[model samples]
Target chain A: SQQGEEDPQALSIQEGENATMNCSYKTSINNLQWYRQNSGRGLVHLILIRSNEREKHSGRLRVTLDTSKKSSSLLITASRAADTASYFCATDARETSYDKVIFGPGTSLSVIP
Target chain B: DARVTQTPRHKVTEMGQEVTMRCQPILGHNTVFWYRQTMMQGLELLAYFRNRAPLDDSGMPKDRFSAEMPDATLATLKIQPSEPRDSAVYFCASGLVRTGRTEAFFGQGTRLTVV
Candidate 1:
């Protein structure tokens, strides 16, 4: 069973425009991490936000976590065509031990140049 | 540069054939995870291991699927008789856990095709 569910199954944006994707999860999580996949091959870790931390940033990526609402959002600033990929929100379940990370259905982003 | 490595980037086999995939996690990282991705089912965690110990494999089909960490640096997933429905890209990731500081680094997945 997937704990995180991402909104906006697919999105199309022009180059340089900002893109935002949201994720809602059930139950408590130790941490929320965002990943990007290209060509349906491998995943690249973008950023991680702890349950205690509300927001985090890395380069053009920004992730915000709201445990109260059991949701999180990823914002891409000044998005480029290269930033286009499938984004997934993965939750490290608090109850499970040994790094039980569950991923949600990803949001596919297409950047038009 | 430390990164998880997976062998046999692609495999094509007939139905009922056995399939074996291997993974080598990054050095000093104690945690390993195996995941399967398909067109319909996004991503599913098949198994997880920490320090050569399997902590969870609830998502896997127990009858045909088996996962093991032969050593700290080696992890393997085997299917006795793979079916057409078992065709998918399998990924392996490793990480060092401590709250939010850990991030699992993944490898180029093994794309399996059962005909």
Candidate 2:
């Protein structure tokens, strides 16, 4: 079963506009990570924010976690045409002696050049 | 930079044929994982191994699917008599487990089509 669900399933944006995607999960998580997938290719790790942390940034990516609300959002600042791809949020749930990470359906962002 | 690698980037087989996909994890990584992705199921973890020890395989189907890590470096997912419904992109990921951090790096994935 998927732990997280992403909103705004598809978004079209201008090259310089920022794109934001939201993810909601059902259970408590150890950490939440964002990933990017190019069409027909593998996924790339974007940023990982631990439970105790509220926000993190990497390059043009900004991720914020609101554990109180069981939600997180990924914000891409000054997006470019190359940044057009599918974004997914995966939640690492704390299980006994191990962890299970469940990925959401993902949000497809298309940037017009 | 170290990364995981998967073979047979694409495979098309008729239904009822055996299919095997292989993965090579990054050196010194102790954990490996296999996951399948489709338009409907999204990404599902089929199995995982820690130091070549099978940790969990509850998500895999018993009748036709099997996953094994024959050694520390190699892991394989085999499907006997695959069905059209099993067609999906199978991805292999590996990560280092140290302290309280677990970061997984994934391969390019094998796109399989069972017609």
Candidate 3:
């Protein structure tokens, strides 16, 4: 079963606008990571936020995690046409001995140029 | 740069035929995962291996699917008598699991078409 579920199945916005995607999971997680996939391409790791950490930032990407609510959000500031891709959130369950990462149904984001 | 590598980037086989896919994880990475992506089901975890040993394969169809890690560097997923419904993009990912950090690197998926 998929642990994380991303909201807003699809979103479209202007190039300069900011895009926000949210992911909610059911069980406790050790860490949450976000990934991006361009059309016909493999997924690329964007950023990771550990459960002990509340927020993290990397380049134009900002990620926030709330362990109590079992939710995480990815914010892309000043979105560009290059940002047009599917964004996925994955969770590493704390219950598993190994890092069994479960990915969620992604949010398809289209940054219109 | 080190990355997971998948062979046969595009595969088209007839229905009821056997199909085999291979993945080579990065050196020293302990975890390997296989996923299938389709329009209906976004990404399904078929199976995974830790330290060259299978940890879980419940997500795969035991009748037609089998996954194995022959060695620490090689992982193979095989489907016998593949049906049209088995047609989807298969992805291989490798990651290192430590105390606090986990990140996976994906390979360009193999787009399978079982006609």
Q: Write the per-residue lDDT of candidate 1 for residues A1-113, one digit (tens) a residue.
A: 79999989999999999999999999899889999999856999988888999999898888999999999999998999998899999997787654588899999999999
**lDDT rank order:** 3, 1, 2
TM-score of each: 0.97, 0.97, 0.98
DockQ of 2: 0.67
Candidate 1 segments exceeding 4 Å error: B99-101
Preferred candidate (lDDT higher): 1 or 3: 3
Clashing pairs in 3: none
What's the CA error at residue B89 for candidate 1, in Å?
A: 0.2
The TM-score that candidate 1 achieves is 0.97
Alpha-carbon lDDT, every model: 0.92, 0.91, 0.94
Distance from true location, Cα of A111 in model 2, Å = 0.9
Clashes of each: 0, 0, 0
Best by DockQ: 3
What DockQ values do the models have?
0.77, 0.67, 0.83
